[model samples]
Target: MSERRSISSGSVFEERIGYARAVVDGDRVHVSGTTGYDYATMSIADDVVAQCAQAIRNVEAALAEAGCTLADVVRVRYLLPDRADFEPCWPTLRAAFGEVRPAATMLVCGLAEPAMRFEIEVDARRR
Candidate 1:
């Protein structure tokens, strides 16, 4: 059987919601949907572009803990409350994912909190 482990980023939501930031099962890493909120400060930027950047950083942190990098990511999902906000985030998204070119999807939907303008989730394989 493959070994299974979970990683946390010390976010209040993790404890309240009872979920890990990411779960590592053998070489495969499944990162939870991460928002712009900085776990350390519990703060989120109002701007979607800034939120996108921060969300990317949060996802990267989880990937790192799972012994993987952005290059290892094979799939990604972007969630936004507004469809129009997606295009403005293109440059930032491309900067992080342009090289890796992982299979991706974007959904326009309501988030847990109204303040959350963007969220990101990823799946990666440890090399």
Candidate 2:
């Protein structure tokens, strides 16, 4: 049997909300929906595209901590408060997953905060 590990990005919400950024069990990693907030500054961009970029970076960091990368992602989920925002993020999202082309889904829905225009979640298998 393999061990389980939890990775944290030091986001206050992780503690306040009672969740880790990602959890690793054996060869798989499950990363929670990450927002655009730069954990270092605790600030998020107003532009949806910019937010999408940062959100990808955030997810990458969590993946890295688990010895994985975007290339190892097996699944990805993009959540947006406005469906219109999804198209604008495609380029950035494609830049990260174009070759890897993980299974993906984008949903139109509300987020934790009104300022949060985009959120992303990923599942990865160690490769």
Tens-place lDDT digits, model 2, residues 9-123: 9999999999999999999999999999999999998999999999999999999999999999999999999998899888899899999999999998999999999999999
Location of the lowest summed lDDT over 10 successive residues in candidate 1: 60-69
lDDT of 1 by residue, 1-127 (tens): 9989999999999999999999999999999999999888999999999999999999999998888889999999999999999999999999999999999999999999999999999999998
Candidate 2 local lDDT, residue 25: 97
Cα shift from native, residue 124, model 2 (Å): 0.3
Where does candidate 2 have its weakest 10-residue lDDT segment? 85-94
TM-score of each: 0.98, 0.98
lDDT of 1: 0.95
TM-score of 1: 0.98
- Cα-based lDDT for every prediction: 0.95, 0.95
Any runs in candidate 2 off by more than 4 Å, and if so which? none
- Those runs of model 1 whose alpha carbons end farther than 4 Å from true positions after fitting are none
lDDT comparing candidate 2 with the true structure: 0.95
